[model samples]
Target chain A: MNGFAIVWQERALFLEGLWNTVSLVVAAIAISVPLSALGAVVLVEAPRPVARLARALIDLTRCVPFLLLAYVIYYGLPQLGLRFDAWWAGLVTMTLYNAAYLAEIFRSAWLALPKEGFEAARAYGFRPATLYRRIVLPQIAYASAPLVGGQIIVMIKDSALLMIITVREISFAANSINANYFTPFAPFVVAIGMYWMLSLIVEAWVRRVASGARLRYG
Target chain B: MTWAAFETLLTGAGTTVALSLAGLAIGVPLGLALALIRWARIPVADQLVATYVSLVRATPLLTFVLFVFFVLPTMGLELDPVPAAIVTLALNTAPFNCEIWRAGLTNFPRDQLEAAEACGMTRTLAFRRIVAPQLWRVCLGPLVSEMTILLKATPAVAVIGVVEITRAASRIGAATYDPLPPFLAATVIYTLLIAVIVQAQRVIEALIARRYGYAAP
Candidate 1:
């Protein structure tokens, strides 16, 4: 197609943007996973007041649209004597927004666990620490894997939103090319393809891990 | 002056809510059709629908909106901006709702459908009487939650120059150079909207439980 020629000429730019997207995703997930785990544990195991506070915070964050949240961090915060570069702003928004969602996913999985197992673990003279260590985390770790992977895919797809913040992610590259060439077909299609492939790869990897966990746990 | 800004934001929020609800109003039935096709396992259509759902699910909504808004005009098929947006959102949601519908369809017992067929009910009739009610009961919760996500995602359409809530907020922020207050107000509207949605889910779930006597967990 005529448009493919334009896209091919822009391959270098596209590849650079792809790299940035991948790097941002990796960093966001690395940070957010632990934060979500902490949030999940707080929602599940903490005292009532602490858990309520955590939930309200999560709910408030989750309800706002991610675009507005990004604008808040990037635009709003700068006026309040805080400024962040586009990359870090994107990273923080991605981490904080999805951590709220992932925490909910993890917390729900934890809640859905059979209470009988925990009770039995307690009945067997297991201390709370050992009971959770030996029993709870393992169960939830596997159960939450597929969901966590799904959320990771969501994060990857959503990273496109960073384009608006000038993050130079793949979508940004595509948008820039469209601006230059006025050919929307090829560049956006390529961006979509890259995203689709990344999601498929993540899906395959998660399937392998989930199956392995099933075999080991079952 | 702030009241006027709030009025603008309120109008935009109405647009946002209207678009999402209209999208779902179309999406729910369209999604069921996709699920039914998949459930019946039609040969070419099964694969076609699968690919459609996968492509839609994997790509970002922004890209999809852009393609609809920009690329479709290139093909000599033009849609006005509002229709284009509704089309984009309805198509965007159909695949997700298809998955949700498929889960309910799959879990529904096969023998009941067969019994309905044996009792001289047509396929459509069977689906209407035997399948639809329970599907609603099974699906209402997840469907409502998905609606909330779609509501939040309404901002993605703003990239195409749709002046929905987030877009309106951005405009106000740009105008006043005080982005925080407008965006914060937008956040409160969204939070309240989502809270109402979640509450409605509870009330409807309770009503369905009472009506149906209980459904499969």
Candidate 2:
């Protein structure tokens, strides 16, 4: 192939990897948000032992490297007679990791809510469920949007770890390309560019949503 | 699965802890220096510092490890996996620690420094006697959290062939033709170590706060 042809081929390969990265991130984040919200509510509303256990679990989950977690779930589950379909290992592991972080973000936002607001709702004869659904959840989402957005960005970066678990994600695809080409610079650099672009998009979207919420509620 | 192999994994835990401590030893001082230089508003250096920090923060840790291990060989420096892992880990952690310390230093009370200057103390002496101690108090939480991060991040070093717990687990997996037992053992060890570190951080932070008469929540 001529130089221009080779360059075009590399670009195509890179774009495909970029698309994969985006899809994986979307899949991970799409499911993670609600799971985290529910997990956060449980941690906060449950008794002291439950809260302590939840916090410990979050810390434990966050401590292990994503690659190691991916390895465990990918390879360890089958031995326990629980074999996931292709892509499930990566998705499940990433979701679990992101959920832990998202839970912490939501928990902090929950704790930061004005006690007076809750008190007023309670005094007005609102049930706990009604108080949470009507008054508290909205405020917590507003307060936690940027932080939760940041966590999602971190989660996207972490999805690269799924490559180790045999997921044909962006980094894994890039690595295969590099192996065939015998040059690390092109494929790896392209992957980095993809990550940078995706993260920039995430940050911009987060800012826009934050401003929209402010305009609506301010 | 055997007790004997479990003992080997336990030995590997020591390697992980040692690598983490080594990274901390190098990273903390280097990070503090970079933080000071970056925030000190020096001539022509501030922009460079900011750029360096941005590059490090934006790149994935895996990329950093791959570059250091694979690319550095062509540059005439032949570093072993452990050293390479340490270099990357320390470099990765430094930018974070630098930012944390810089935030602490910048947010420290301005009036106290002014008061020290008004008392006719030299600038270095003022920072030493007045600002540094106060900065420590403000930075305590972030510092503890960053250390916890360092401990947590040690597992990444395994990627470079360091015989840390994760690396050891990989070895067992490869040998046994089974990944579960070793990986599960590593996971348990990792979870336990992290719990211990978190608890230790809380205790140390509480002790420091109490000694300084500052209430810890």
Candidate 3:
């Protein structure tokens, strides 16, 4: 078979890698967003000690590279006598790292609100929980959606780093294909092209959401 | 894992600092020049610089580092990994710096320029006396933040075989077969280094703001 035919024959394997990438992103973000939102809310409302600790941890996480963090999670966890599969390792690391960033975005959005908005919510006989659920979340979502969209784009790019820990993501699959075919160029080029297409889709979605939020909230 | 191995990793920190500083030295001026070419209505240079910014910003740092370290030599221009990585990192960062600096320049008040012109000041003198000072003051915060990113990005050089702290840790890990201690030690070093850079940038920013009479909101 020709080289192109050989590549075509591996289509299922490559598509599986793409599927893994999508599922990992969806799972990680699905888990992280609510946790991050709660962290952000608590960070803003909690007592001084908890707030200080949360801020410090977030700062440290943001400053470290994701690959290094993944390495720690992937390799360091075994010392505690608990092992994670490569998929779980990637999910955990991505969620933790991106949570730190998203929490900051969330906190900033909350802080930007008019102080009178909170007063008005309290004056309306709404419980704190009901107030936040009804009034605050919608506003924060409108304000923070653009930044959160950027974070999602970043997360997609970062899924490639999972290759270091042997997860069969797009980049990892490409590397393996290159090893078999001895053509590094095609695989890497494909990986880049795939990443670019993903980012463009993300950017378009962000724009649509941002415009919708402006129309609804403004 | 031993104290001796840890000491070797600590020694490599100096090289990381030097490479970062060298990149800053070249990148600042190059970035400023690009910003001016874009802002000053230079015909061909403006479009080219804008495209350069978008392309560089869109691509991953890892790809650029890999290309510099691996691909350039095959095209006949050879550089050691240290220089190659430095070049790539600086080029990767320059676009953002250029755009940020230009934004700072645009933030200057138009009335000041008109006032300088009213005083019969030449354009160069007007920029020197009125615009440049305010630009630097306004630009310092963004510059400090960008510098923090550049410091963080020095680890990327380790990918290209530079024996920076990250590479040193990996080497020690391979030889001793204890990846945790060295990697953890490197992590602590990185954290400490970032803290120091960030605090130093803050101090300098405050001092410059005070000296220049720039008000913070």
Candidate 4:
């Protein structure tokens, strides 16, 4: 039988894997976006010591590999009497890992904004919270959308690492198919194709969003 | 952690560094060749290189590792874990490095090459003397960052049974029944390795900038 035929016969398994990957990506982005936004804000606008500390923490976290970070969270946390299920552990690891990159992206966008806008908002008697909400956040969101989208694609790809911790993602499904049929190429190539398609869709969506934002905001 | 655990982790780290260096050694030349082919605008080859880069970038490094380590054996090209890891990493990194090198090439001033050719220099001589130096300067920062990324990705080889630092930590963790200490040690070691790479990048960037009589911004 051809490789595609083999993969077709295992369509259910592949679909399940794809679904798991999507779910993991969604959950991770939902958790990380707000957390990273807060982190970016602190890194950019907080007091000197606080900003320095946030920057250091983000740097340190980024230096560690995501696989190791997952392993640490999955295995190491149990020692502290804070055990989590493999799914939750994987989710937490993805959030923490991607949050650092997202925060850096957001921080750069925040830094690139002109200072005059913030001063103008302040002159209009807008407090820090209102100023950020009414002026800064919208600008950075539009400016950073493409990069944020790219990072989301990255998060989707990195979700495969969760299979190492036994999260039963697509890679895990592929491994099982490989083990059972001894057909490594079929399952993995299928998974890679799925990942590629997902990323292409994201890239297209991001492009549309960017152009739309340019027309609307500019 | 015990002294023995530290030793084990260090040994694994040594393997990680060695593998990463070997991968870079192969990948840099291959990537530069791809970039040059595209830059020369060899039509079919350029399209093929573009497709390769896009496909590789879209997939995770883990997939590459698994494919190389597993599928190749069926085609009678069996490899041990370390070499398999190195080959997979080199293949994965080549596409990224190609993009980086291409970006650097965009910064190359065309007039210098034109002038060199007008002055009777061979294409090879002109590129060797003029274009190559500036290309290295433009590419160095991104290349170093990519190397650190490749180094960080070394742990992915553990899935194929290679005992890199992360794998070493897991083994020690299982044996000692204390996962935190070994993982903590791995974190520190990884952080230090990245710090060294970043520092080297800065020093090299400064040196190149100085050689060109320009202060690094």
Candidate 5:
């Protein structure tokens, strides 16, 4: 069959894969961003040794390749009698990997905050939680909106690697099509197009958020 | 793990290192050319370069590796796994390095080139003398980070059956039925490799800074 016919015939499979990819990205971001923000706060506010240890752990996580990390979590965990489904493994790996990067981004944003802002909020009788919730956290979110968005884009791209562990994402679907039909070009080209389109949507969305944050905060 | 398994893993790590270096060696020059083409505002070439960079950046490296490994054979251009991995990686990396170089070029002052030209230097010589050194300074940190990324990506080549470090780790784990050891070993190797690159980056940046009579960033 021709490329168009092949794509049309497998439209449902492609759609399923697309849905899986989008959902995986959403799940990963939903979980990881908050963890990263918390880790960033700990890195900045924790005592010296605790912060140092946290920084080292973050560095170690960042150094290891995501694919290897996925393999370890998916296959290695089973051997340790702590098994997870392939999707869970993929989601956990993405969360852990991207959290390290996001933590770094957030930490920098936190450090860049003016010291006087914190003192002023304290002087205005704001409790610690209230100070963070009302003043500090909002500014960090606003300042790091662009970088956090970039990391999310990276998270989207990285989700494709989950296919190797049989998560049946778009790349996996493409591989199956290639193996079944001996048609390498159509499936992969379509997969790449899908990924590119996803990235564009993310980029546009991020730009809008960043501009909004700039206007609101500045 | 036994000495033999450790030896095998080391051999695989060597392949990983070599593949990353080879990819970067070719990709960096290609990236520089792409950056210069865009910098010159060459009408069609600039747009083509933009498309290439964006496409490469947006898609996963795994897809690009798969495409190079599979599609080239259909066009009567067969490549073995190693060559395919290297070619795919260089293709993947060039676009990123191009963007890095472009950023460096953008930050560089335009008047320096004019000054060099006024001093009777040709365009190429002007770039070499006036622009290249500062560009190298600005680009070195990002490029080193990119190299670490390329090194991390070498494992993706294992999909096409190149048997790099990560694949070797998996194989050994399967053989020994102890997945943790082999994978942990691979992690250590990768971390050490990246640490070396980071140290070397510091050294090179310091040397450049000393020569230019400025403190390193």
Candidate 6:
């Protein structure tokens, strides 16, 4: 009761943290999904050596832990004459880590598409960019909506790790409240509830879009 | 990184592997048991299990890790860093495995069990002889993926001072003020480690498929 009371008293801090977390995820998804689509297209359409290089990089990003990658980007980059503020570094790392995962997803769905559609687009004399824009992207996006939703939730969760680099995201704000009020349980549980709510909303939205895609495209 | 730093990272990687394996060992069976409880539809127990899975699936591993490490002590269940980490990993992964196992259980062909019962096989024997192998064959791929995710999550334990590979990298960076070498080394180690897991999964999946005549999955 006392711990929760403290959390309620500092509701402003939690709300602020929640907002930062939302902004990070929205920004990360905006950047990562386009980048992922580009990477996926490259993997499927590029020449052998270039495709292989893309595959290797995607696999590397997939295997590396997000937190470790963030640490590297935050601490190691300056040595290479690259300097990003911790906030931008967090966003960039989120983009890098989840882009690989989403790219893998999109790439597989792209491969699974029927060969006739692609060949038909080619024979119609459609430009390469037009073929991709009209045929390739829409089909993959529909097929991959559910998985992309899952990854979006993952990105939301991973945003909490940015607190380690002093980004003052939800978990950081909760932790600071703990540091001040010595109420660990209340603040973290509150922060996590917000995350859970965000995930549910994303999932519901994905379901809506997927059903619509099915009606329109399937 | 110097040779000493390399040695330190190796040691940290070892700890990471050990913790993840221990967590997997506990989580797999625990998940199976939970799935069974839900499958049986035993009144309140089934509903409890469902809620537990949903709740766990909704939260992040780091939030769960922080909760166990920081909040558990106030409830009069204090634990050291390593044990707390193992607990956190096991708790976090079990719900995922539960879902995987439940999928196999629900989708299992009911006629096989009926035929076994008509053959006068006991319920235990029917499950042991028929259901278990097929479940393994069905669940192996997703189970392995979960294991890899758990391994990737080991770094979250570092917050409470477990000094796994990522933690060691951070420490080395702090000591030398040049994080590139150690972090790069850590990345290589983690990549190689996960590759081993994936490769082993391939070997195991091939074996299971051959033994069970796996078809679609």
> What TM-score results for chain B in every one of the models?
0.93, 0.90, 0.91, 0.94, 0.94, 0.94
Consecutive 10-residue window with the lowest summed lDDT within model 1 chain B: B208-217
The DockQ score of candidate 1 comes to 0.79
| Lowest lDDT block of 10, candidate 2 chain A | A1-10
**What does TM-score give for chain A of every model?**
0.92, 0.88, 0.94, 0.93, 0.95, 0.93
Please write out the lDDT profile of model 4 over residues B90-139, one tens digit for every residue.
99899989998998776677888889989999977887898886787778
What docking class should model 4 receive? Answer: medium
TM-score-better candidate, 3 vs 5: 5
Highest TM-score among the candidates is held by which one?
5
Query: Which candidate do you rate higher for lDDT, 2 or 6?
Result: 6
User: After best superposition, candidate 1 residue A160: deviation in angstroms?
Assistant: 1.1
lDDT of model 3 at position A5: 57
TM-score of every candidate relative to the true structure: 0.95, 0.88, 0.88, 0.94, 0.95, 0.94
RMSD of each: 1.9, 3.0, 3.1, 2.0, 1.7, 2.0
Q: Write the per-residue lDDT of candidate 2 for residues A25-122, one digit (tens) a residue.
A: 78888898898898898898889998888888887788776777777777767777888854788788888988998999999989987899889999
lDDT measured at residue A29 in model 4 versus the true structure, 0 to 100: 91
Q: Identify the leading candidate in terms of DockQ.
A: 1
Worst 10 residues of 5 chain A by lDDT: A148-157
DockQ per candidate, 2 decimals: 0.79, 0.44, 0.35, 0.75, 0.74, 0.74
- Candidate 3 lDDT (Cα, whole model)? 0.78
Mind giving the per-residue lDDT tens digits that candidate 6 earns over B1-217? 7899989999999999999999999999999999989887889999999888867777877777888888998898999999999998998899999999999988989999899999999977987899986787789889999999899988877777789999999999999998988998999999999889989888887876687667328
True-vs-predicted CA distance for residue B126, candidate 2, Å: 2.6
Regions of model 5 farther than 4 Å from truth: A216-218, B117-125, B215-217
| Model 3: docking quality category | acceptable
Q: State the lDDT of candidate 4 residue by residue for A122-157, as single tens digits.
A: 899999889988899999998899989888877887
Residue A119 accuracy (lDDT) in model 6: 94
Candidate 3 clash pair list: none
